[model samples]
Every structure is written in structure tokens, then in C-alpha cells.
Target: MTPIFPAKAGHSVRILQLCRAIKALGHELTFIHVASKLDTQKPDIASHVAFFGERHFLHLDNGPRQARFAFWLRGKLRRRWRKILRGFGHDHSHYSGLDENWRNPWSHQLRAMDRRFDTVVVEYAFNSRALDAFPASTRKLLDTHDAFADRHRPFVARGFRKGYWVSLTPQDENQGLRRADAVIAIQAQEAEHFREQLAQYEVSERNPEIAVVSHYIGLDQPLPDHGVDHAALYLGTNMLSNQISLRQFLEHVLPRVVSSIPDFRLRLAGSICNWAPDIPNVEKLGFVDDLRAAFARSPLSVNPTIAGTGINIKLLDAMGAGVPTISTVTGVRGLGGEFNNGLLVVADHDHAAFADHIIRLSKDAGLRRSLGLAAFADAQRWNERQLAALDHCLRGDALTDTAPGHVARWRDRTPPPFPTAT
Candidate 1:
């Protein structure tokens, strides 16, 4: 169950891919979407049908009318106060008043269903309370996209404003984890953190087992040997972290590259184009329908992200498309460093080095092809590893053999060291 409908965002893509993976394993899936109070857009029924099949989906207007009214009123007041504070030269960007105790009123409906489910998976820890509706015989799983306990501290430390999302105290987060039979974390680091939190709190007798399951992307066929155009690609949404990093790249890095290679262009796609500044040689192709064709057109991609949690899905997508990419250390977090031949990692805010790498990669076609091949190969192995781990979790088996650092031992295959770009 999820509050978010599948869309173009990373989290949404994870949801879509996960359902597809589950179905591939020959398990019947019933998708249930609990309406989010913040979203007003109607659910895309067609997309849901395409994934879960006809009549296998449920949309619940779960919250009570009184609670909804209170939430709406609070939102209005918060917006008004923000506007007023902005006028006073105060920054209220980090303040997000989220209610962690919000529960679904329609959970009782789950009890009335004629069929009994063997396993019930809830998307976020905040919604793990829904597991209460399922019988004790049903195995409960919580797919935590990111850790919520003190989630805002990282953004604040990096000088970025916090966005709207649930930020729970460790104690509250522990309560949610205790409800699940197994907790699925998006990355290894987060899995360790969850284990630590649960150990520290000692909430319940049911010590939920934690497992690491990264994002999954279908590998794209290798690009043809005709060679790519002399342009780079950047795809992202208008999330605050993207906004900060992209703006910094534009201000600090783009100019250096333009000076070095005057005709070189940077292609921007997706909702991120909405906030990106107008600049020379920066082409804004907003909301491109064909992402594969877009990646095919460019020889290289850039993930200049400096802050955020979880695996970077866009980075994985670029690797899946067999495109060489340059990313910051934070952008490549939780991914296997040994298999990063197609990726160039830079320190955060190191604009000069970032620009230099772009220039060098643009001038070297043979190097680009070498990295792209490595990327494609790594993507295949990574997908297999993630699928295997997910299969184990779904089967209620202990992941002792497939633990974080031990994943490289899968199939007894050793990963080669990343090829240097010099």
C-alpha cells in the first residue's frame, strides 16, 4: 500500500518497478492507495491499471472529515505565516508541521475483504499502522524509502531548506518499525541505521528483521557505435535538493565549461526546467516523453546532487541506458563503489574539478565508450543482486548471506576496479 500514485519521480519509479518485480515472481498483487492530504490531483487510473491489472487496485479516501478539515486549515495557516515571515526578512524554510500520528480511517475495510493475503507490504514507515488491519497470520513488510527519524538534520547541515515530509522522533519511528515483521530499507546504510534505532529503543518483543533492497531499473540496450552528439544531459524534478544543486552547477560550473568548449550544450529535461535559469548553450527541453532517446542523444550525463538520502534513481537510470555520468560523492551514496567505472565522483561544491571532468570526457570518445560499456555491465549485475535480495525478503528468509558488504560475493563473481579516465 502507498499514498503516492506511480509517477515520474524517483520514489514513484521505485514503487512501479517493485510491483513489476513482485508480479514477475508469480505473486498476485492488490494495490491499495491511501489518499494523501497534500495532493489534490486525481489519481491516474490508467497507469495503475497498466501495472496492477484491471480491478486489482483500490483508492481509499481514508482520513476522517474532521481530520481532513483540520489538516487543510493548518496548511492554510502555515502558508499565510510563511508569506508574512518572508516579508519580515526571516527564513522559515526549515519549518514543516507534519502530523506523525495520522492514521487511515478506511483500514477497517481491509478486514472485510473476502480473500486472505499471505503478505502485506506498506510503502512508508509513516503508514505502517495499516499493518494492524491485517491478521497475525499475514506477514507485514514496511518498504522505507528513506529514514525519517531526524531526516531534516542532513539538509540543514548542508545549508538547504527542509521540504514537506514526515520527520519523526526516533521513538515514534521505532514504534512504526516494531509493527512490521520485516523492514525493507532502500540502501545498506539506512538498513544499518534502522537496526541501530530498533536496538536502541527496544520497543517490542517482535524484533523486525531489516533488509537492504536498492532501486531496480531494466537495462537498456547498448548505444550504437555511431557515437553521440557533443552535449551533456541532466534530468531531474523541481525538488528542493535538485533545485539547490542544479542552481549551484549553473552558477559555479556551467560558465567554466562554456568558456572551454564554446559550442558545447547542456540539455535540461523534466519539471526541473521550470526553475532553471535561462543561459547560453543550456537547452531546456521540458518534460521529454522519450527519456531513452534523450539519453541516447547525449554522450554523458551529470548528477551534481550534493544532498539527499537513498540511492540516486536517475544515476541508476543513466547507467542502465549505458551512458557515462559524473556525480558528487553524495549522489553515489549507498551504491557499490567497485562497480563505478561509468561514474566519476567529485567532492561536493568542487565546481572547477566538476567542469574539468566534463570537458575531458567531451573530448574523449573512446573513453566515453569504455565507461558506457562498464556502466551497462555493472547495471546488469546490480539488478541481479537487488532482485535476489528482494526475493529473499518476500519469501520471509533471513538475509544473513546477502548482507550489505557481502553482496559482492553473489554468484562468486568478483567486480573489477573502476577504469581511470585520464
Candidate 2:
């Protein structure tokens, strides 16, 4: 699947899990993307391009050109039968956007790919022009990492403005939800929201269909470091919520959090955008390449966000290492761990109340230790490796692979297309 985000911005864990799943299942898979060629230019190949595959396709020139030819030749997914039957089997399903730049034109290619495979796994509710692109027989799983429209449109940078797929209106994304065979929500609350919104928008569906799958990171080997322990801290990069959340914590949350504690410092780390505050105890660490050194020194990782969707794997990362942690209710969205057990406390939605909780946690080291111990204990219950298996088990097509036989045999089946009005 195409994941548009950079590897560093928390998408690596999920991608790695997917890679591991494919490997464990013994699937002879191949990844086609511009990254194959770009890896030669990367300084750190060991870290950046770690996934092993039968083929690392360099499609900077050919694939897109083929896709365009396919799009033109196929004229929507169903009509391009002969073109798709070549090279790849008719069973070859397509996924992810080639690039965010192609967000506008990706619908056709995805739709074409949709008809090609018996299952189409969509990561984003991108290009909606080809809404019903999935073949009637093909299983469609919408693995939602985040609520794009909610986070993007109302974010601090482009508040309420329209983005490219003016059609991906909450209305349109909700449409993809209705059309999808199943919906996979990363966080529990978002899974609930997916169900609620689907019904609210009257997308035809029964109940209990949206699957709540937590975002996972496979840590087969134990992490040697437990992270730094100190006062209060916030760390993230480029995300809109990180900008607003940190500001809210520094201005409204930290003072109350440190009211009882003396010399409490809140370190702000990661690549930041739109710097708007100057707090005394706050340390600004712009663009941290290796967070291990930083995590090794900090006491608590604080997340004070009220907006956005998906489980914060960042919070999981902190808890995984037995680091003292505190998060806003919205921040610890899908964690199965308990407060004072895995995480220290959930910041109350009210600013004063939230700060008060942080203040208490910051002042009490005994409390931090107790929480850190509990958090580590809870980490035992979260098996990232198992989560990958469960995700793969969701569909029948995902149940088979290696040789293209099952998919290759589909060359004779006719691909169904959606109505043009959409």
C-alpha cells in the first residue's frame, strides 16, 4: 500500500509490521514506487529502506507512465482488462497514492487497480472520483490511520479551508466508508466515530462492521533504554496537533501542572512549525535526528491535544519503555492501558483541570515511578507482532499469496465499474 507520509513521522512502525506480516506469510511480494530509485540517494539505507522484497521497483519513469497509459487505455478500471492482464496478473490489486501530487489523478489508477485485485486495501480516502472502484467481489478494507478531513481542514495552518479533493468533503470520505466492504479504525474512539458517522450520513451498512485496530509497532527485541525521566515534556514533528497541543500545554497546562512542583521543566522537541510561545522552563529542540538520547533523559512525555484522530503510537512508544507519561484524553485515544497503570494520567478536557492533573503528576516522583512500572507491565499485553497477524486475517485474499496463481487465474473474470456520476 502507498503511505504518503515520510518514514520518520510515525508511519514506520505500521509499514514495518506490514513488511513483517508479508515475510512471515512467505509471500513473494514486490513494492513498486519511486523510493526504489531514490534509495540510492539516501544516506541511511539500513534505516530508510529496510523491507526485503522480491523486487524493489524503480518506477520514477515507467510505472506512472504505465499507469497513465493504463488509465487512458482502461478508461476507468473495468474497461482496461487487457492492459492489466499483462505483466501483473488480473489478481494484482493496487493501493496507495503514487504521490500526494497525484492526489487529484489517483482515483482512476486506484480504481483500475481495484478491479485488478480480489482485494484492495486503501490507506487513505484520497481521490474520490472513482468511489465505487472496488469490484463487487473484491474485498475492500479502509485502514484509516487518521481522520483526514477533520485533521487537515480544521488544523491551525489551513483552518476550515478546502483541500484538493474538494470532493473528499466529510461527505465524500463518509461515502468511501459506505462503499467499503469493511472499515478499519486505528483508535477505539475513531472506530466508534466511523460507525456513528456512517450512520449519520446514512451510508448503507449494518452494525459492528468498523474494525478497531490499534496502530502497532513490532518490537521483537527489547528496547534497551527506558527514556529520560524529569518534569514535563512534549515531543512531535510537523503534525498540526503537535503545534496547538504544545502551545496549550505550555500556556494553560504547564503552570497548573508545575504549581505544586518546583523547577519543573517542559521540553518541546522535534521539527516544529509556527512557533508561538516563549515559556521559561520550556526547552526547544528543533529537528531531533535521534530521539533515543532525548528520551533517555526526559522524565515524562506529555501530550495535550484535543483535536485529531488515531491512537498516538508516540504515547505507546513512551509507555513501551516504561517512561513516565501523561496525555490529554484525545492524546491517548486507543491505548488499552490504564491510567496510573500504563500512563500517568489523562489530561482532562478542561484546561485548568488538565493542568491540575499534570501538576500533580509532575510534582510526585513516587507517582511517576508507580505509573512507569504499571505502564511497563501493561506493555506485555500489547503484542505488535500479533496485531499484524490479526490485520492480515481480515480478508480471504490476504489469506493467500507467494505464487500469483490464485490472482493470476482471475484473468478471465470481468471487472465491474461504478456509475460515472460519482
The best candidate by TM-score is 1
Tens digits of lDDT, candidate 2, 1-422? 34322444565555455544544544443333433221222223333344442233212222466665664444355335535653363322212222322322444444444225545554555522233655677666666666554443353244422221112345555766665667767765777777777777755645335665555443322234433333555677655556666666667766765565557677766665237466576777765654545555565677776765567767766665566676777777666433336564554467776666666665566666667666655554454323432445344323223121121112233212111110
In candidate 1, what are the lDDT values of residues 301-378, reduced to their tens digit? Answer: 899998667888889888887888999988999887756978999999899999999999877888888898889888
- Residue pairs with colliding backbones in model 1 are none
TM-score of each: 0.87, 0.65
RMSD of each: 5.2, 12.8
The whole-model lDDT of each prediction reads: 0.76, 0.51
What candidate 1 gets wrong by more than 4 Å, as runs, is 1-6, 38-41, 63-103, 157-161, 202-204, 403-422
Q: With candidate 1 superimposed using the best TM-score fit, by how many Å does residue 152's alpha carbon deviate from the native?
A: 1.9
